[model samples]
Target: MSGLAILLLAAGASSRMAGRDKLSEEVDGQPLLSLMCRRAALTGLPVYVTVPSDAHPRTGLTGTATTVPVPDAAEGMAASIRRGIAALPANTEGVMIVPADMPDLETQDLMHVAAHFHGGDGPILRATSENGQAGHPVLFPKRSFDDLCELSGDQGARALLKRDKVQYIALPARHAITDLDTPEAWAAWRAANG
Candidate 1:
C-alpha cells in the first residue's frame, strides 16, 4: 500500500480501430496493454486493470497487476471507471487513472505522476505536455473518489478535471497526450516514432 493505486482503463471496445484490437497492437515488441500494466507495476504501486471479459486472456498481464473484469464494459467508459475505482485497495489515498491506448506513455511517465502525488489533501495532479496541454495518468486524491465513482456514460473524468483545485505537471515528453484510437492514427504514430 503505497497510499496510491493505478487504475488501467482497457475496457473500451476500440470501435474506431476498424476491428483491430489496439491493446493487442505491439509497440517495441510488447502488447500495448501489457506494456502499460508492466510499467505501472514497476512503480511498486498497486495496479488494477479493467478489461472486458474477453480481453483478459489476451492481455498477457501477470505478476503485480491485478486484472478486473468489467462485465458491463460495453455500457460505456463510466462503467469501467466505476468498476476500477471500486476495486482499488482501501488504503488508496490517491489513484492515477491511465488509459491503455496511450502508446507513447512510458514507464518513466507513470513514475513521474506517482512521484508527484502528495496525499489526500493535495490537489489533483495531471500530466501536461510542454505546450500546456493536459494529458492522461491523472492523479486524483481520495477526496475525489466519491465523484469518480459517480461518473457515468462515455465522458470518463473530464468533468472532474474541470473542477477547481487541479494542478498540472509538465512532462517534457510529447507522448503524454498521444492516444491511438484509429488505424490511421496508429499507423501514423508508428511511422513517426518507429
Candidate 2:
C-alpha cells in the first residue's frame, strides 16, 4: 500500500514560549518531536519532520529521518508545508500535514485519517474533534500539491478547508486541536493530560 506520508512540521520559532523551543521540550522524559515522530511511526507510515537547522541536540530521535531548515519558515507554516512537499518521494501519492506540537495525537487518530484517504472517497480528508472543531493532520489528495506549494505567509492550508470538496472525519480525541504554544498553555495541557 502506498500510504500517505506524514510531514511533521516543527520549524516554528515558538515566540510565545519566549526563548524555549517547544518541539524540543520534554513530555514524560521524551522530546515532543521525538514522541510525535515515534507515535506517527507506529502506523507503519513514512514519517519525516521538518526542523530548523540549529535545533538543540536532542538524542531522543537521534537516528530518525528528518529534513533540515525550511528557509522560509520564518514566513510561517505554509512555507514548511511547501518545503516538505518539495522534498517528498516521487512515489508519495499524497500527504498528511501535521503540526509538531500535537503531543496527544494518537496512532488510531492518524490511522483513521489515513483510512479516509485510502478509501478513495474524499479529495480532502480533515480530522475534527468530536465537538465539530476541525484540525490538523489533514489529508490532501495529490492534486492539491501545486496550490499547497504556491501558498505563502501564515495561511497554512486554511483556505483549502473552505473549498467545496473537503470532507471531515470526526475524531474522539480532544488532542485534535490542542497544542502547547505559550508557557501557560503548555503547563495547562501538561497538567490536564497528566
Candidate 3:
C-alpha cells in the first residue's frame, strides 16, 4: 500500500521557547521545520505544514509542505491539526501526524507506522517507543475524519484514541516521542539521542 500523508504541526505559539520559534531554530545548519519537511518528503507522500501566517519563508517549507495558516494558533496545538486535516487533499488515504519540532525522526520510522495501517485493521494506529511508550506521528485512517476536524484548543488527538478501536505499532526509536518543547528537553534530546 502507498504510505500515509504526513501533517507537520508547526503552528504552535512556542510560548515556552522564551520568545524563540523552535521551527526557525537551526539544527545542523538547517531550520527545524525545513529539516522535518525534508524528512517527511522521503516517504514520497505529499506533506502539509500548519504554521502562522507571518512565519518566515526561509524555513524552506513554503512550497514543499503546503502551508496552512492557523489564525488561532495561539489557542493551542490542536488548532494546527484541525487546519492540517482541513487542508489535506481529497484523495488522502490516511494522515501520519508529526510535530515539526521532532526533527530527528527519520523517514523509515514514519514508513514503519504507515506500513501497519491496512484495510480493516482499524483507523487509529500509533508508534510506540522502545520501552512500550506511546508517541506522536500517529496514523489516523480516514475513519476519524470527523473527529480530527472537530479538534480545538490544546487537546490534540488524545480523544480519538479513547474510542477503543485504536491499534498500536511499536517503532522502537526514542525519537518517535521526542519533541522540542523546552530548552532543557531540547538540550537533553540532542545530547542523548542526536
Candidate 4:
C-alpha cells in the first residue's frame, strides 16, 4: 500500500436521495464519508477524498485524508475522478477508487484488493461480492493512469474497466457492492447492519 493512493469519491450530488446527502448518512455512528476515509486510512494508503468544493461541509469530516476539491463536481463522477487522479502523488504506483457511498466496505476488504496489486505488472484489480458480483474499490496500476485522467461525464471508469484485463478479488457478503444512494437504501442497510 506504500506506493498506492486511495481516492474516496464523495463529490456526487446524491440526486437520487431527494434533498438529502447520502455521504452524510450515518454509518456506525459517524458520517459515511468520514467512516470511509478512516477505513481507507487503515490500509496504510494515502487517502484523498474528493468533495464538491474546498468549503463543502464534507471537507471538514475527512480527518487526516487529503481533500481534493472538485470545482466541476456538477459534471459528475468523471470530474472527481479526473481531479483525484491528478492530485495523486507523483510517485504513486497504483490507485484505489473507493466510492464513499459503499458503507459496507471494510478495512479488510480494501486490503484484500490492494494486496492483489503487485506493482508494475499488476492487472487492474476489481473487488467483487463473494458470489462473484463485480463491484467497487477498483485498483488501477500506474500504466493506466493516462486513461483514468481522460475520463469524462458520470460514466466513471466503466469504459476503461470493460476494455482492460481485470482480476477480481471477492469480499464477504455484499461488502463490495453495498452503495447507499437513496434514503430507502440507507434505511434498509442500517436496519440490516445495525
Best by lDDT: 4
lDDT of 3 by residue, 29-143 (tens): 8778888888888888888888777554533554576778888888788888888888887777788889888865888888878888874336688877888788877888877
Candidate 1 structure quality by residue, lDDT tens digits, 84-103: 88988888899999888998
Enumerate residue pairs that collide in model 3: none
* Leading candidate by TM-score: 4
How many pairs of residues collide in model 4?
0
Q: Give the CA lDDT, 0 to 100, for residue 172 in model 4.
A: 97
Q: In terms of TM-score, which candidate is stronger, 1 or 2?
A: 1
Colliding pairs, model 1: none
Report the Cα lDDT for candidate 4.
Answer: 0.91
lDDT of 2 by residue, 3-89 (tens): 478888888789999888788789779878888888888888888777655454532352365655676679999888888888888
Q: How high is each candidate's TM-score?
A: 0.94, 0.91, 0.90, 0.97
Greater-TM-score candidate between 1 and 3:
1
Candidate rank order under TM-score: 4, 1, 2, 3
For candidate 1, report its TM-score: 0.94
Off by over 4 Å in 3: 54-63
Residue 186 shift from truth in candidate 3, angstroms: 1.7
Off by over 4 Å in 1: 54-56
Steric collisions counted per model: 0, 0, 0, 0
Output the lDDT of residue 112, model 3. 79
